[model samples]
Target: MTTALRTDRYELTMLEAALRSGRAGRDCVFEVFGRRLPGGRRYGVLAGTGRVLDAITAFRFGQAELDWLADERVVDDATLAYLADYRFTGQVEGYREGEVYMPGSPLLTVRGTFAEAVLLETVVLSVLNYDSAVATAAARMVSAAEGHPIAEMGSRRTGEHAAVAAARAAYIAGFSATSNLEAGRTWGIPTMGTAAHAFTLLHDSEEEAFRAQVAALGVGTTLLVDTYDVRQGVETAVRVAGPQLGGVRLDSGDLPTLVRETRAQLDALGATGTRITVTSDLDEHAIAALRGTPVDAFGVGTSVVTGAGAPASGFVYKLVARRDGTGADGGAWKPVAKNSVGKRSVGGAKRAERLLRDGVAVAERVVVDDDGDGIPERDAADAARAEGLTARPLTATLMRDGEPDPQWLGPEGVRAARAHCAAAVGELPAAALRLSPGDPALPLVTA
Candidate 1:
């Protein structure tokens, strides 16, 4: 499957720029830096490792792409030639897929010669932008649900590949399962679903629909109860299928009231074990609203798969460091940088640090240095700085040589990582997690 970049606004020189500059034995480093949506957003989630891998797999240049490169005349023959044989023989470090990151936190760090690190800017963002947005939304949904499981069934509702990736990212962000059949088949994510309204509409009665589903899919099937009326549906469901039915889904109507009253009905009907699941424009906020409800699981759609408030993380991979000049050994140095309004990216090889100020992470900063003294910040800036703490940055060695990673984690492992992130999220101020109109801006320091 040769999946090219879905869109082609990414410049060819992005890769070639680093390579052409780095070939002179000068090292270049790229940092992905950005913040959550304004209004003091608490934090952002790292998303899109799967899509990043896909882009890396499809990062090769085909004839059409090469023609565009040539037509643009973005680089010289030498740089393009270097690209023809290029593979990411570099090191990548950053927040894991589900990690909670603050502003100035390097969501991802790419280190290699100038060329290799720079070439990957666009495709990486394409993956991270959409996926991270969805993941962040999914995380909020999880938090709102208060431990209620979530299902992902937004594939057909979205585009094809978007659906699969959304389901995968949602699972990593703590969704209990997905409803996309192919997502289940492909990623080993547990799939859950029931008869749609169409199934019930196809039958003569809601009772008939429930009975047919229980017969075909078994008594463990979750019955859709709101097609007509939830109380009456549950009553009919119990009469036909007996007690101990699996669950009943509510698609429309006032959910909190419905769950409360439906709970009474099911319990009265001796179907106490039956659970209530709700789905109807359920975003993180709606999930939060249903916290005390009798709802069991939430099927998240538009809000999760499409990033709810801030759709993309706006993570930008920029060359922050390159050779400033020649070294004492005459090997030359690659000093990097990027200075733009509202988008001043760091330059040259960089390292990031998260320092705990009295057991609370009061500050996060990035250190730019060529030869590290184990103190990760810029030496020149320290002299100019009036006050700040020096700490080892947080970018880790994720990929080396050229590979997917030494240990490929499954959805379960990612789920564990998400748990760890959730714990970290607890340490941050409570305001950042709110999905309401106001989110306090979390401050950061990049030295």
Candidate 2:
């Protein structure tokens, strides 16, 4: 396997600042602000809170980070002063994880001031945006699978931290388990593994290798049936493990054809009870192609982790609504915006309304303000959401009143994503799952 170094350039710098002074109760406000995709996206999933939490923990501001920050002095003296005394003290509010969201929806809000909130932006977005994108893609794939088990094995394709977060995201999107050990350790996800070609190649013969593995791992161990000869591998696997062999996995060649022939062979050999799994160059489109095949599970690597072939959505963080030093509603309340084309953002706190027709999500719209009032209802309201489903996903209370609450989410927090993804199954527009360019876009209206 190819290998390379993974990097987190700014984390140490910021954490050092947090570590240096390590102050407890500083007020700050952190907000998540991003807009629609190029083609207006009406609905979004609150995808990556679990992964975001990971980075926050990593933001420990230890001695190493402090040394780097001092060595470079990335910020001025005043900025450094803020960093040394960093600790968020405020409250936060946002749409619950897995809730359907929309453009201008505050995915999250951090309520600590200056140092506390500002430093967290880079790290939090790094985890949330990346993992959320992967989770969104995985949700679509899981929907297509119709309850088939999904195995994630994309660690080789991404950075180390990204690999871990991808596993969490995929889980949140309803995947059954991951091949990432780190994810298993950090997030409590079920970890699974299948023999690679290397294992087979290490043995004197494929038969000998299969025997050794079955002996060590039991008959339930899945046999990789595509090393040298697909049919030969399957036959050898049967000879060694008999009719009760747990499963035969195909990693190469045409998947549908392989499953058909492989199933026929297994059945003829009285191994009908054995399951079939497929992997290799697969994506959402590929998985969709195997609708009624005998394939029992899918091992998705690159595409699912990287976002169903959509590498990354251009999501950004902006100060859409801030309490700029002004005096309007008892304080300064001027809306500020960075008016650039294609990247313009609304100024002011925002909310998202997930409109439902019947009991399913139809689209999402945005409402901006600074108040406790909920979102306004539209002309047609689904019975399930008549009470209104607005998301003010950002607030400023991760670290509050100079001390952090022990209520921080653990690594496995993405379970909620998985549950929500399951809940949204029947609600997703089928056409939206297509890989083609021309389908109805997720509608996004800004007010």
| TM-scores for the candidates | 0.84, 0.82
Worst 10 residues of 2 by lDDT: 1-10
lDDT of 1 by residue, 1-447 (tens): 433334344455444554455444445567776744532456666767645754665667666755666788866787667656657776677666666676667677766655555567777787787887787778778877878789977775678878887887888778888888887877678888778999999999888888899999877778888887777888888887789898888889888888899999999989889888899888877888887778888897877777776667777777666545434443444555556676665554556655554445555665666652123543533532334533333565566665666333445545555565566555556566687655433466655
The candidate maximizing TM-score is 1
Off by over 4 Å in 2: 1-30, 38-44, 57-64, 324-330, 370-408, 438-441
lDDT of 2 at 311: 54
- Top candidate, metric lDDT: 1
Error of 2 at 25 (Å): 14
Error (Å) of candidate 2 at residue 116 is 3.4
Residue 391 alpha-carbon offset, candidate 1, angstroms: 8.8
lDDT of 1 at 251: 86
